[model samples]
Target: MSSYSGNVETGGAPDVRNLPGLRITKLSVGPMDNNAYLLECLSNEDLLLIDAANEAPRLLELVGDRALSTVVTTHQHMDHWVALEEVVAATGARALAHPDDAEGLPISTSPVVDGDRIPIGDCELEVIHLVGHTPGSIALVYRDPKGTPHLFTGDSLFPGGVGNTHDDPEAFASLIGDIETKLFGALPDETWFYPGHGKDSTLGAERPSVPEWRARGW
Candidate 1:
C-alpha cells in the first residue's frame, strides 16, 4: 500500500505519494489551510501545480529549481488562489481555470471545461467540471495505469459531504446532482480523491453516505 497519509498542516511538512509515472506532493498553506498539489511527471520531471493557495515563498521553495509548466486553480475562491498571481509570476506558468470562474482570478486564465485533457509530460489529467461550490468548480482526474484513479476535488467534494452551497436549496440540488451523476456515478469505488482542504478519501468510503447528504440538504 502507498505510505501517503494525505494529511498536511499549515507550516508543516508536505506528504508525497508516488505512482507509476507521476509523483504527487501535497502541502497545506494560507490561513484557511488550503491544500496545494504538485504533480510531477516522472519521465520528464515536468510539473503542474493544482492550486497556488498561499505562501509564495514556501511554494517556490517546494518547486526548487524545476520549471513549473501550469497552474490550475480549482475554483475562484480567494483563499484558493491567493498566491496564484505571485506563483505564476515567479514561475511564468500558464494559468488555467474553468471559464465560468475565470474572471474572479487575479490573472487571466485559459478556460478548461469538462473533458478537457491537461498534460504533464507523459501523464495527463482529465478535467471534470463540478457545479455548486462555484459555477466552474472542477476536479482533475488522473487514471494511473498501474494503480487506482486519483482525483483532485476542489471544494466541490470532501470526506463527509459536498462543498458548502450557502444553504441555497437550488444550488445544493445542482451541486449534489452533478456530484452524484458525474463523480460518484461515473467513477469507481476505489478511486481515491484529494480535496482542496483536509484529508483525502476514497469513493468507497464516502459512497454510503450519499443518501444521507442528499436528505440533509446542506
Candidate 2:
C-alpha cells in the first residue's frame, strides 16, 4: 500500500488531515473515537465519509452541511455505520459497503471490491480487499505527492496488532496470516494505518509484531 500522510488535527467537527492529493478530517464521536473520516476533494468540495459511526451533530458540525457524494462502511458492525442514516439524511448521500454486509445495515450499499477506485475530487482511492474480519472487509489505500501511502484498515490492523475476531475459531489465525503476509507485510514502513476503533499506528511501528502474532497462532 502507498503512504498518504498529511495534517491530522483535533477539535472541531472537521479535523483536517492533509495528504498530497486529498485532505482527511477525523471525528471522534460516540462511546469510542471510531475514527470516522471525511475526505474532501481539494479541487472540489465533494465529501466522502468513511465509517459513519456516531456523534451525528458533531460530525455534521464538522462537515457543516456540505454535499456528500457517498458514505463508505468498512464492515457490518453497528459502530462502523450506525450513523449512516443520519449522515445520509443530512446530506442526501448514497451509502456503500461490501455486498456480503448488505442486509445487516440500514441502507443498500454498492459492493466494494479489490482494486476499485473511489473518486474524491481530483484524487482517487484504490481499494484493498481485506477479508476474515468479515466476509467482505476492504481497506482504502492512497498515495500522496510525497509518495507516502496511507491505509484505512477499519478494525483489521492496528499499531501493534492485527485485529479482533469473534466469528470462527480458525478465523483468528486466517485473518492474522492475511494481515501478516498480505496486508501488513506488503506495505511500506511509511504506510500509516487508521483502524475503525483505536489510535493510529504507522506501518513501521506495527511490522515486527506480525511474527509474534503468528507464533501465538493467532
Candidate 3:
C-alpha cells in the first residue's frame, strides 16, 4: 500500500517480497563520499536512517514524508554526522549511538550499548561494539529470515582491511582484536557487510587475510 519509489541511486526496483521486506538504499554523500543508508521495513513502513553524513537535501528527499524511527550514527567522527543534526531536526527521529562516542557527536544521541536489540518492524539488529575506530564505534547485525546475515559496520570494518588506526598502537591493537574475535570469529563467512563508505564485502572474502593483516601490524 506504500508508494515510495525510493531514490535514483537504488537502481531498479528491489524485490521486497524476495528480500523479506527489507530494503537497503545506499547514497554516496558529503565531501568524503560517506555512505548514508536508508533501511526501510516495507511490512510496517518502519524506516531507520544510518549515518546522516551529508547531502542533507538528498537525504531529506530520500526520507520524504515517511516518519523515521531512528537516526543512527555509527561513530562519533565528524564526517559521519555532518548532517546528523539537520536530519534529526527534519525527521524528529531519535538519535542513537554508542555511549563512548556520544559526547563528541554534534547532537545529543541516545546511548546504545553492546548486546542491545534495535527493532525494525518484526526484525531486529544486534549491536556489536567495535572499539579502536573510536571508543564507541559500533556495528549493527541483522540476520535475514532466509539465513544470511547483514552487517552495517560504520568505519570499524571494511573491504581489503580494517579502519585506519592513524598510527595509534593501542587503538590499532584494540580494533584488530575486536575484529578478529567479535567479527570474523562470531559471524559466518557468507555474512554480507555494508560499510560506512566505499564498496561492500563479505566475511568469506576477508577472513583468509586475517593473518596477513596481523603480520603487517597495521
List TM-score per model, in order. 0.99, 0.88, 0.91
Best by TM-score: 1
Candidate 1, clashing residue pairs? none
lDDT (Cα, tens digit) per residue for candidate 1, span 88-157: 9999999999999998999999999999999999999999999898999999999998989999999999
Model 3 lDDT tens row, 1-218: 63433232322222121256688777778578688888888798888988998878888888898888898899988999999999999989999999999999998889899999988777788999999989999999988987689899999988888898888989989999999999999999999888887777899999999888877777
Prediction 1 TM-score vs. true: 0.99
| Window of ten residues with lowest summed lDDT in model 2 | 1-10
Deviation of model 1 at 92, angstroms: 0.9
lDDT of 2 by residue, 1-218 (tens): 43433323334343457665678876666676577888888888888889888877777776785788888888888888778898888888888887877777888787777778888877777777677788677788876756788788988887767677774557777678778766767788988777776577788887877788767654
Off by over 4 Å in 1: none
Residue 18 shift from truth in candidate 2, angstroms: 1.6
